[model samples]
Target: MPINSFISLFGRSPIGPMQQHIAKAHECAANLVPFFEAVMAEDWVKVEQVQQEMARLEREADKLKKSVRLSLPKSLFLPVARTDLLELLSVQDKVANRAKDIAGLMLGRQMAIPQTLHAPMRAYVQRTVDASAQALKAMNELDELLEAGFGGREAALVERLVEELEDIEHDTDVMQIGVRQQLFKLEKDLAPVDVMFLYKIIEWIGDVADRAERVGNRLEQLLAR
Candidate 1:
């Protein structure tokens, strides 16, 4: 089949579906800001609303992931291995999954962000979201990389994006450490269970950035091949 005809028939190139999945995942990550803000205000209603939105976006991203996997042709020729593409999709999907996990944890406990940790927590969330955004941008370049046969300026562009993603993730890690220190300092003032759950929430929020870094690593592996 002609390339354009095959795409028209098959819906889109593999990267297209993958991009949609990452975009949805990014949407889920984007909600973390408002969700955390709501939590800070002790506005359970707004927190629940944001949680629902994250859940909805996560479910939609899951559907897109399934569709992409099922529709991906086994015999279709491409510049990269099918396994690599699948791995990339799986990693990207985890970004959304982590976002939902964070949301669920917050709602389950009605977790409140301590005033001392508010600024650091928000910084952590923003950095994680930024990492996810950069990863998505790198994923967006996959089609272009394919067109360039995975070399030249396109590869250089993605390489730089991956570097930026790594840097953002590192910043989030620092923020996580700082937040943990603050949490520990304030732990004495809170109920023991609240302290435990707060730690869990902070760890899970950091996972979002870790997952985003994994996505970038997967793309780097693809570039290597």
Candidate 2:
């Protein structure tokens, strides 16, 4: 059977509004990778380029939402599909925005990655990015799983992903505290503004992880129904 037909036989339609939202969310996730990579490399020029790409992706996602709304029947989109799509778009955008905020913080401060904390902090950002991307993938497929009335594995999978994210979040917290302590011990003269900016960037990155974990929780709830 043809690919489309195969999916149709499983009681799913390929031309779903949710699918478009999922694609847009994945685009955000893809954009985040480059942003994290640039930060890790301390490639300031490439960081600006990543920020520009994220802005473009946001515009694309907005256009997609408009197109989807035009095709969908307002009545069919109720508490489930409509709300889920909106939440997905919002969460995806937050990921990109948080990444952009981190880059903006770096640019504004003209701060270079400190040698002592460089490796651990870079690893932390990269891991968080990976978790966010995985969360997006799981969320994007949730509608299909829900519609198919698939086994309990849907919730199980989401739980596992969220658990992994939680683990990473703890590690980030530990690393942040350790780095801050190291900074204070080595240089008591560091600018307050610089410290504030670092805190904001770290908070924003943590927010992205929190949002991704929330998305997983929402998917798990939808799967249970």
Candidate 3:
């Protein structure tokens, strides 16, 4: 099948459903840092805006999925661009949802991050977001790589993204431990439920990085094929 014909059949294009979702994923990943920073700093207005934007993007992604399902030719798309795009979008969308999930946890628990804990957590999340952005950027170059049908730079870049995400994940674990240690020391003033909520949000946020890493892995697999 001609590439254009395949794309029309499956709703795939240079700036089609997959590209749109991936782009939003990068934006969400980047914005999450400031979203949490706003929470820690007690900036309610910014938090509300970022949270809304995150929710809006996620909803739009879902709509796109439904559009693909109802409008595209399924048999023609299996194991091709449509399937690849769907998988990529699903993974990317998870990051945004996770960010929103963390925000919801903050609201539900009225948990503001400790001042001393802010710096390390902020740095870790920023790194994770950057890694996810890089992963998405790599995805943008995928078509070019496939067209060239040649070099190993794209593969190498994907490997580097995975490594960077691993480092980010490790840093998140360390920060989580440090934050818990400090919280433990001051546990007399805080309720156990609040502490658990805090930990839960942290874990979800960490999963955003994990999802981003998985995106890099998927891109690697697709490019290799």
Clashes of each: 0, 0, 0
Q: Using lDDT as the measure, name the better of candidate 1 and candidate 2.
A: 1
Determine the backbone clash count of candidate 1: 0
Per-residue CA lDDT of model 2 for 1-225, tens digit only, reads 443454555544423655565466456645655775676677878877877776676667667666665655443322346555566556655665555556666665655655665666666666666667767667655555654453567656666766676676566667667666666664555577766666676667666666666666666666555
Q: Rate the local accuracy (lDDT) of all candidates.
A: 0.90, 0.61, 0.68
Tens digit per residue, CA lDDT, model 3, 71-114: 55555433346576567667777876776677666655557777
Every model's TM-score: 0.95, 0.74, 0.80
Which prediction has the highest TM-score against the true structure? 1
lDDT by residue (tens digit), candidate 1, 43-136: 9999999999999999999999999999888856666677888888999999999999999988988887778888888889999999999999
For residue 189, model 2's alpha carbon misses the true position, in angstroms, by 4.0
Report the lDDT of model 1 for residue 77: 60
Give the range where candidate 1 is weakest over 10 consecutive residues by summed lDDT: 1-10
Candidate 2 ranges with C-alpha deviation above 4 Å: 1-42, 69-72, 77-81
